[model samples]
Target: MGKRSRWLLWMVVAVGVVGVVATGSNGGAGEGEGKGKVLEPVVTRIAFGSCANQSAPQPIWNAIIDFDPQVFIWLGDNVYGDTKRPFKLFGKERTFGPWKNAPRFIPSSPKELESRYLKAKSNPGYSRLRDTTQRSRWLLWMVVAVGVVGVVATGSNGGAGEGEGKGKVLEPVVTRIAFGSCANQSAPQPIWNAIIDFDPQVFIWLGDNVYGDTKRPFKLFGKERTFGPWKNAPRFIPSSPKELESRYLKAKSNPGYSRLRHTTQVIGTWDDHDYGLNDAGKEFGGKITNQKLLLDFLDEPQDSPRRKQEGVYTSYMFGPVGRQIKVILLDTRYHRDPLRSDGSVLGSSQWTWLEKELNGPKSAITIIGSSVQVISNLSATTRPLFSLESWGRFPKERNRLFKLIADTKREGVFFISGDVHFGEISRYDCATGYPLYDVTASGLTQAVEKAVPHVFSLIVRFVAWLTPTTMRVISKNCRFRSCTYGQPNFGAIEIDWSTAPVTLKLEVKDIVGYPVTGVKFSLVELQSRGSVPSVKAGEHRRHCSLEVNLRWMIKYRLAILFYCSVSALLLAMIGLAYAATLAFRLFLHKCKLD
Candidate 1:
């Protein structure tokens, strides 16, 4: 590399570094490791978002803090890393090439990745927050069984203890869940505060956690690799484990993300960007290493079922009986097949597991999460219908999922998805069960009107902007309100179990936490609805009753008073002891003089 070329290369790297550091923390747990301290809170408030550019301004984090969520979810696009490749700005070759034939990128050595993670942690904003907040790390999925919130202790070194007699047990119950996707660290993101305000107990990351494609032709090889007519700038495709680790490290050190992690319990899965490339599947050779990196980042236990699998699909049951909430996170990437005319998405074993999970006894409410849309067809919005990344591309599997829900007669089964750059709530009616509602919230930082992958994308976006109705037409089954497709946004699900039948409130909010749209469903109502019902979601939204709020306030005040009284008593005793000691000393002096 020439002096100018070397400078330019450093400049690009500096751009990513400066971008994250400008909005990052001063310090954080290194190697994506943190100690876990278990707290058994009865109800949890959760927050989730995605598509964050580590180097971008994240004002949304402030608003998220205000809501006081107990947990946060990084759906995907948490960071854009992958030093192996450079993003092609313009050309016929825009999309990533095949993995097998792709060239390897440099400067993505293990040391380089570690340095990225370390620098990201050094960002001032994240450092301050992480330092003060109570944080822990461990496998969150397997431990979250019915009525239990299992937490593992975080050693001083931010790793799990290898001491003798370590066991997993049931702990606490979760009550709130927030989720979203598609964040670019270099893009504008002001959506986090709104998520924080929503105050979810558990945040579910749908996918696209980080756009970590590092496979740049020029950066990978000495010369800029040219592409044919069909390809575009190649996505950052990491061919080795080292490149993958670098991307993750960069993401973890994001300032806004650092703060959120400090304040709340977080868990998530991966999408294309963080997994290695755009629209990658099982054919990606680095699946094993990537899985380990992702799991380690999420603090998965060594004995986690995820460790035993080739992909990152897992399930958790939370809350006690009568209020149990089962969450099933699906891995759409690891073992996925190519998108053929008749294609398969979830491989055979995952399918078997999904079937088994759905067939079993159901929770009060069951949430099935997919990184991509399960019931949306954009043929209405885009002409010629070019890209099909959603479940719509795999009709057989999609129907199988619907059929399984129907066959199980599961009452509160619903889907939460994120992958598209927009947000909406779609419903799928089942033959034997209630209609399935898929809440699609995406792009914590990045949003687009259409899903077209090429230059025509600009035109599709323009048309969608001109005719907003075109976008709504694409979501024919949307139940809550109109779709949010123009700017950054997020989605939330609030459950109230105090009533005889539990109630679920679904919401899609803008970057500032304003409710763009919302809907409510009684568990009974959700179970009975055979088809899409004409209901006003705004009116039916289950609100926290005044009685409950007031009662909680009273109890909180009493607790405070009790604490004050105890503190005062301790002070009085200390004072009394001090005075007595002084008097004794005076008496001793008098006796000696006499």
Candidate 2:
């Protein structure tokens, strides 16, 4: 062949090699789809997050290590960078993954950033998390491995007067199992090394990675801006670039994170704060446009559930074990209706997709990472401060969803989330008699939102109390459990897919201490002891009496449509009220009202 021909051949080989590495060897999002014989009874442990502060001393890493989770998920509230570009990464129907085009991999220029991720990873306490075994060979392999992608670089060159020594993009995203440790050790670093050290396969970002002036008051460009004086005491504020960079760097620098870099995988979806406000969406000025950018930062796949569907709700599976872990990353703020019209948590398009995913014949273990509280109630406070920014407001939608889960007989439905500045687990019964348990984890760094004054927050507490009784109605064959948890803490779920009855364990670890450890609960026995079940939440909204009838109606087209319409209408009413209140308050509080 001529010299030109040889060059072309070489070029093609190089391109092919890059493509393979980029898609997989470099680490792909969907690794479970691998050709390897998927092990049976897939053992999986998922670490769920809700509210993580963009601050130092996020000790929950200790709890996560103690749990030895296989996967970690960010349910939302990752940080508080409200002003940062591409702010609305969470609370949307359609979501893309992280942005790859950003200058994340470049090392030389990002000296400060490199130091940040590297030093955070190198924390001596997390050494055990990185070096899981004592053997020299294991230690050698871990130490020698290089070129891990878990290290992310963010910030800008200070063109817009951000004028710190330098500015990074300040994103709350990671796409690997582990990356660095002590990448850049800073002064007075929270004795993170003094506590339990552990590493996670994937560090899933829950949300609020940046605050973005969420709790503070004021309006700029027709958008909510930071104005202090809390609606509730110690109200949540948006995250600044420094805070965002700090949180990401600290985690990235930790050696335990290297697993996310080389050995394990990472994946996540967001809730609010990652956007700009607590319950914001596309119509919030240019927020929708920012949503697209957020997706890029997240590295979400276009063909994935969130991309193909309406909301950020998606799924992922790892290992075989005849188990599939479906992660429905529910966006609470994006397309939701205001509180006046019954309010919606998810828009119509996304709702349809959600039903299908739930009913689809696919997996045994279904884990839904909800950004907001699904079962907890907030009525004691007058402002609805504890109100239904969650599922409680959209009763119709929740009912429809419950019906779907029950009708579909979807088993092991675990709802994990953050945002309440607290944590709790509540088991909700389904029409099919199976129970859905929701676990809330908030404030990996910051403190939980305190009890607001009045009946609104009180009402929420009351409703929460009734959950066990309410769930008991559906769980005649099975029983449900419930409880409240607080932070600085993190949550985890462990699954034993080996035997006839699968075992699951839930944990909440306190990260404020040196040798961190916290609460734990294990469901060792598969209470149902039956085959995998399926149910569509919409089918049973008609108040069907017989279980057989509920299943039978699922086939009929009209029933589902009616349920959808009803849910939409209910959601709209509540949303309208909530929006009206906020709008009216803007006028009333300003002394401009007639």
Candidate 3:
């Protein structure tokens, strides 16, 4: 072996290492398939976190990658750059330096915000970890004492199994999911690092992704406004869709959001703040324009009906039958009926579509995401109190939803909601079916100063009713399972398939990713209680027949009475007209036939 031979060996070793890092051993996307193939993971490990404050040091980034989530979810409040200010350079010297900073400094402006996103994209940590066509892969490892190792499965084109006992295709699994909401850009956001450590396969944005362009004060400005302003930053209220788009551009560029964008797949819907208003609904003027911008920001499919439709509600199914999971995102803002409207909360078309979905097919677990609380009411004291924005406001619709679940006996169905700046769990155990659980997590950055108090006084309740916008700032009293208020927190839902019946674990974690409170439910517990006792056919028929006979008799009497009265009136009127005509004819005969 000479010097040249030794040099050749060294070069070979260097190239091999580079290939491993660049292409990844888990299986690069479209290795053999060719260009532009849709890629996914065989097993999804979602890391969900929201309420991002761009200026804050996101220590959570360190923790996020430690957990090694396959996807990152932005559950609303991704940024807090709210302002009516334009992209103009007003106080550049004040915020930046003698050296100019273009985008990030003006956190709320649209045009200037582009630079912020560019800056975020340039982050070395995010660039290195971001998912790419070359590095797309899932490295499955059993959690060990010190680390995770031991390859389980690996392939390209969304985790195709490579020769498992003579080439068996492995189905994708949705194992871990995390979510949260309500972030402020100026606030301290170390919790993101903790979320990274938790390591999820996918993240779900529960809404309030940003506190953009809101009139509400950052802290308590007045008794009427509970939610604070966007980190008390300079206001940047977008008047047009283009300006709003600019705001979105700035939000996407936030380092935390930017890093997550590269690291994993993200999906989300909007709350009032993100939708360009506080507690907005169907009457929102710029809904269509704002919706278009939102879809573009979310990278929604060009062919999706959401483009043509009025709302943003959508559903997605993952995995095969036995292990399948369905995620349903309900658009609570767009096309929502007015608070006290006679129609419905979900509107007519959406209501019909929802019913079809619930009755159509069954998934191992179904998670319904609402931007506001669904099961819990604001009142926990004596008289029932209600939230103007929650499902409680529309009792008719809420009961209809409950009845639908009971009628269809839908199983493994639970709700996840955000907003209200807190986290809690509530349950509605139906007599005819299994317990329905609603787990709400909120505020990745902003938390309430105090929980909404349980109201017992009638005077207070009446005042609240007259001024619904000024409802007391009260957090739910933990009765069902657990509750956490007045803290920046996130939520997690984990599904385990290692047993006969699948189990789901719901958790609410603080900014540091510590589980403040949690609850677990098994498939058996979510299912209907052994087909509601069947009604006897004979007895049911007898009761139905008797009711029908009674109704028919009453209807028969009413019909006859109406007919007789109408007939007598008509006869009298006709006779009177005839007599008058005869008298007129005698009088007219003396006059003219004209």
Write candidate 3's Cα lDDT for 506-532 as tens digits: 888877777766777678888777654
Give each model's whole-structure lDDT.
0.62, 0.47, 0.61
The number of clashing residue pairs in each candidate reads 68, 145, 49
* Order of quality (TM-score): 1, 3, 2
Where does the lowest 10-residue lDDT sum fall in candidate 2? 175-184
Worst 10 residues of 1 by lDDT: 540-549
lDDT of 1 by residue, 447-500 (tens): 764234566755544444332121122333333234445457788888887777
Error of 2 at 362 (Å): 2.6
For every candidate, C-alpha RMSD to the true structure in Å: 31.9, 23.3, 21.6
Estimated TM-score per prediction? 0.57, 0.49, 0.56
Off by over 4 Å in 3: 1-170, 185-188, 216-239, 379-388, 450-482, 530-594
Ten contiguous residues minimizing lDDT sum, candidate 3: 141-150
* Strongest candidate by TM-score: 1
lDDT by residue for model 2 (465-514), tens: 33222211221211112244332555555555554565665544445432
